[model samples]
Target: MAKPVQLTWLTGAQAIRLHDAGLRPPRGPFAYALVCDVRDPALAALANLALTDADLADERAPSASARTHFRARRSLLRALAAAALGVSPTSVRIAYDSDGAPRVDGLPAFVSVSSRGPLAALAVASSPLGIDLEPFDASAEPVDAVLHPREQAMLAELVSTARARAFLRIWTAKEAYLKALGRGFKRDPATIAATCEAAQFSIDDGGPAPLPVATFAPTMGLGDLIVACAVTA
Candidate 1:
């Protein structure tokens, strides 16, 4: 049997340095990598990597902002592929399924990444894995529409978005679950089940049974983004 591969998370600068300059520790065999980001410097680096210089220069700053965010996502993904395959950052190739989940062709491992406004996170593993980081934001739209009636009731008891930043916890957990499946919002948001107790929980999916992923919902960041990670065997 193959030994379990380790999971590592890094910021954009860290990932770039680690991959391009060999500044980080060696990742063991079959490890999967994930990088998450919010739309900021991280996005800039990712965009610069993906867009041609001429095209980028011609792009209107405000109008192109959406593309910039998408490009940044691609850049992080490209870097992950390169790092995972032990190749030059430029040599990493990515292919995606109909769902837009990323995969490195011909590699035995799986890598996943996600980004939000100012933060980003990545996860890699021998087994499939997903990760997410979200800052608590009071302005986030009501999540009640997506929450299970039971889960919504529990969320009210555990924390109140009306009073604080409780939504980050649920959002992060949901994001993590989506990432784990490599399907993101493609799957019904409500189908992936978790409790508001701020811990890992299983999804109702039948295959092998979804495992409890990890959640890092700090008590004080109610108004901040909550982060979560899920893995499957």
Candidate 2:
């Protein structure tokens, strides 16, 4: 039987199933990443496999090596995705900043992936890419210190984090945009804010525009983790 690479969001406990579906690794210098809610052991194992068996050369140091299982799974998924898009896996390249924002090179654009647990997400773009996930924590304190005045007002007036679920929804959306742009934690989390209701971004300093909020809604809900991803059109 065949399995879909991604699953639909559902109510009740979020349980994700991960499978390689019997894929063979290809030779390449590749860049592949994924995001999953930390609760997902199956997906973690699968990711481990990708990083393990891949025939990719490390971008930071060509002489350096990756574990077999780790390269295998990540490389496999990247290969599969690239194959679907009619590109070569070996030609795929990944570069990252000190902040851990990953970018694909030698291709038309870039792609990135992040996984926490139950949720595994991928972002592909003709430009830079970013992805972020937050399980939603009301205990995390108000995010105002990092936001601009306008962003602070927006969060105060439009969003609610009293419920853990809603908090994650807003947090993930902002993080996704930051990651898509390769800013990540270097940028103020509060500076780039979103709302559960709006699911859009308000970036300080007039950075990149937010991605279409709808792109993330379809992949939401995996355990306590809520994920948001952004990419170039």
Candidate 3:
């Protein structure tokens, strides 16, 4: 069985402290994810100093909030990658591939970034990986549009809050798998099937075998947000 991905929730001060200390997550075939608030003032300041000219040129968000989030995510990504590579944060460059997936220049590491509300997440691994975040809505109804037929059938057995929570897990798993595949939503989400059991998840996209997915929720004192990370195993 594949090992589950580990997630770390950090504050702006905590992340900065770790970076300063040159601390990196455990190295191996496994993946790791980090989450933090993008709206924090300390993070914003760190982003302003860490971002390079190329990183700034990539910021074309139409609104101020979008721009701020973009900068924060990029800065966080650079910091994490730099720590792993044991280099200066500003020296690390991030570029997007043709599929719009972010890549760390000159490194074999794979990365994915996601945000929901005030929080942002980053996933890193030696292999291709993806991460997704979604705000859980207690009043949400299961939406069949993005679910496979099998998934719809499974969700139909649940009611009210149970159904809503199940839908959130399935949704994040499918989305994360798609991102990991570097296709994102270009491929129909309904074609991907996801099964959730407690903190574990499995995704079937008509592949040779079901892919393992790891999920974390109610993290960092935010009970309303759900996160999922997927990698080809």
Candidate 4:
């Protein structure tokens, strides 16, 4: 009988098994992270595999680079999830909700994935959550577009490179929380105030209270990249 297992290879990327990550259900709680270069030559074989009918839709996305990254990252997503769930990667069905959030068909765990530059990151948990990773690119996105005026003023005081890195850190944090809330772009990013220094954020969505957000930089699998995750309190 074939036994599904977590695939770990230090040469290509950082991988964490459920057991190694100490993330077993009914055992309180734990985190699972896998960070890799989707464009790595070593991952070519996995990325080139055929896509199912459903996945093919996402593969058809415009922009050659994004298309490649999408196919590669999502394919590997199945492989990682299968390793954690002890099933064949191909058989691990992935279904997207109306909001575009992905659900690993057989598991009840919350999952999120993000990719940028040379890295792709993912996480799964027993609770609702969101994860995001982005490289520091000062010109890629404008901080004023998503950050509160007060936060932008604070960012403006930092040196050039440091400011960009800080933007990414705080931006990723905001994204992770929005993802956790399943609001995506439905909620305004500028409405949330985040402090990368504190690795936390807060926002009030007219619910008569503010959302208690638990955000952090996950150091496990990230290599030369900025990463963050958000879970409700």
In Å, residue 104's CA in model 3 sits off its true spot by 1.1
| TM-score of each prediction | 0.67, 0.57, 0.87, 0.72
Q: Per-residue lDDT for 56-170 in model 3, tens only?
A: 8988777888887888888878877666556677777898889888888987677888886458878777677888988888888888899899999999999999999899889
Name the top lDDT candidate.
3
Query: Model 2, residue 230: what's the lDDT?
Result: 52
Model 4 steric clash total: 0
Query: Tens digit of lDDT per residue, candidate 4, span 133-157?
Result: 7765756444598987767887888
- Report lDDT (Cα) of residue 153, candidate 3: 98
**Candidate 1 on 1-233: residue-level lDDT in tens?**
11223445454355566666664345444443444443545345543565445334433335455556656655666656566666654655556667766665666556676555434466555577777777666666547766656556666665345524455566666777777677888777776556544344544444454456566543322234466776666
Candidate with more favorable, higher TM-score: 2 or 3? 3
Which residue runs does candidate 3 get wrong by more than 4 Å? 1-18, 25-27, 41-45
Q: Give stretches of model 1 more than 4 Å off.
A: 1-5, 20-62, 117-119, 139-142, 158-164, 196-210, 216-223
**Which lDDT value does model 2 have at 49?**
31
- Candidate 3 clash pair list: none
| Clashes per model (N, Cα, C within 3 A) | 25, 39, 0, 0
For candidate 4, the 10 contiguous residues with the lowest summed lDDT are 1-10
